[model samples]
Target: MAKTIFITGASRGFGKLWAEALLQRGDKVVATARDLSTLDDLVNKYGDNILPLQLDVNDRAADFAAISKAKEHFGSIDVLINNAGYGLFGSIEETTEQEAREQMETNFFGLLWLSQAVLPVMREQGQGHIIQLSSVLGLVTLPVLGIYNASKFAVEGLSETLAAEVKGFGINVSLIEPNGFATDWAGASAAQTTAMPEYDAVRAAFQAGLTDDIFGVPEATTDAVLKLIDSENPPLRLFLGKYAQPWVKQTYEGRAAEWDSWSEIANAAHGK
Candidate 1:
């Protein structure tokens, strides 16, 4: 059976690729982008299977409105892929107040608004899935991507809590944590802060890690995404690339070790 999937940030990158894949497989898609013109190709190719809407996820009312439009058009929304977010490149010190606020606005609050809007509709239908686009950085810190990391970390917590809260209602929540992908995430989609003299070395080390071989192609993830959508028992979290699991494993191990080292202090603080 074909499903109705709503995806944000579908102008390009993984969002667009996934939208195309879904439509190709005969799924109805509500694709949203800030610039609707960029989605003309999808509109032309998929016709009624795809509905491209102009949306800036940061707007709470507009977010709800988009969800309403999609529900009215498609009858019921089966899934929502909250992929409307961008990277903010800057260390903690280099980041400006405006940049940090904007990052949270789009990445965190936007997802929140959409989730809220879809809940009543999904509750009425008695089944729906909410997929959040997080990152490996949500599991660990990376210099210069502090704001981006914070946004994803916030998403991680929000989605985890949402999953638990909505489980009994027959609504599902999932987080897609992808490592570096050959999308425009780090290119045209990214916003950068002014470089600081002290952070030059930090930036260099970060830049050095971003090599050609590290990124996975956007199209390679189509099969996994399709399976996830069609799943009877979907996971609360899904890692998209080869690097995500290994990298997150190491980060969690280190975190566990550090917590163990402080166990005595932690126990004492909790008041035995």
Candidate 2:
């Protein structure tokens, strides 16, 4: 069966790769980006199989409209991939309040709103898949990326709850946790920090370390995504790349330890 997939941020990076891979496999893709002009290559190559739409998931109305157009184009959307997001790098003290909000608006709330918009159609159809693009940082907080971590953490929480809630309704939700990929996610694509003298020390160290780790081979993650899409029952969480595995495991252990430390208080409060 040729599945129909609507992917946000399809102009570049993992999103574009996924769209191309899916189209190669005979699936229909509603490829979207804030500027459709950049998606000309995809449109020219795949033609009708790839419906390139201009969409900024941050705009609620535009998000809904894109979904609606995709549904109409393909008859129905079998998968919704919320891959629209950018990394905002800065320390808690250095990052502005507005920067933090903008991060959340696109990374967290945008996913939430798009999922909500697609729900009615999926519910009526009785089966659909919602794929969220989160990062290894979503599981663990790293210095100089507090805001990005926060957004991903919120995504993790949202996907977990949404998965359980929608499972009974025959809808599935999954999270794709990829570590640094060679996508244009770094360099020019990354959000620049509003440099602060107080954070100059860590900023220098952070940039150096991050630059080295940003060029991961994206093929590994793309393979993982193909396997997930083909599986009869995909795992709720899929970790990609060597860098992602350790950080995610560490986060799991730390979270477990924290919960155990507070178990007594939690049980008492619940009258256990």
Candidate 3:
């Protein structure tokens, strides 16, 4: 069956790749970007199968309106890909309060609002899929991306809860956690705070350690997403990229070890 897939941030990066791949596979795609001009290529290539809309995911009104338009045009939105977010790179101390708030607004609240907008339609239809584009950093943190990590952590928490809540409605929610990918995500799409003198060395070291091979191609991510879409029973969380599996595994193992080390005290506090 050809699904009517609504994707946010479809101008570039993983969002664009996903839209193009879906369109190529003959799916109906409602692709939204802040600037409609950015999606001209998609529209030109895919014709009526692609509906390019101008949207800022942070705008609640725009989100609702876009969802309405999609539902009107396609009759239903079978799938929604919440891929509209950017990375804000800086240490927590270096990132301003405004920057942190903005990051949360776009990455967390925007997704929340959009999901809310789509839920009603999905509920009425009785079957839909919501795919959230989170990051491996959601499971584990790293230096210089504290705020970005915080946003993704929130995404992970919310998506997990959402998955459980919506399953009864025949709505499936999946979180795609990809590690570093070869996309404008780290370049043009990223926002950086002015560097703090104290954090300069650590930032430099982090940048220096990044290698080309460390970043997988966008097609790999597209393939993973397609598989998730096709699965009769998709996972609650699907981690992409070569390092995602090991990194997430190690994080859980470390967490389990810490919990086990303190289980006696933790349990005692709860009982008494």
Best by lDDT: 1
- For candidate 1, write residues 180-233 as lDDT tens digits: 999889999999999889989989999999888789988899899889899999
Candidate No. with top TM-score: 1
Q: After superposing candidate 3 on the true structure, give the runs of residues whose Cα lies further than 4 Å from its correct spot.
A: none
In candidate 2, which residue ranges exceed 4 Å CA deviation? 211-215, 254-272
lDDT for every model? 0.93, 0.87, 0.93
Candidate 3: tens digits of C-alpha lDDT, residues 1-272: 89999999999888999999999999999999988998998888989999889998999998999999999999999999999999998888888989999999999999999999999999999999999999999999889999999999999999999999999999999999998998998899999998889998999988997988789988877787898998889888888889889988888999999999999999999976
Report how far off residue 231 is in candidate 1 (Å).
Answer: 0.7
Q: What is the TM-score of each candidate against the true structure?
A: 0.98, 0.92, 0.97
Residue 269 lDDT in model 2? 98
Candidate 3's displacement at residue 57, Å, is 0.5
Q: Which 10-residue window in model 1 sums to the lowest lDDT?
A: 134-143
Task: Please tell me which model should have the higher TM-score, number 2 or number 3.
Answer: 3
True-vs-predicted CA distance for residue 46, candidate 2, Å: 1.1
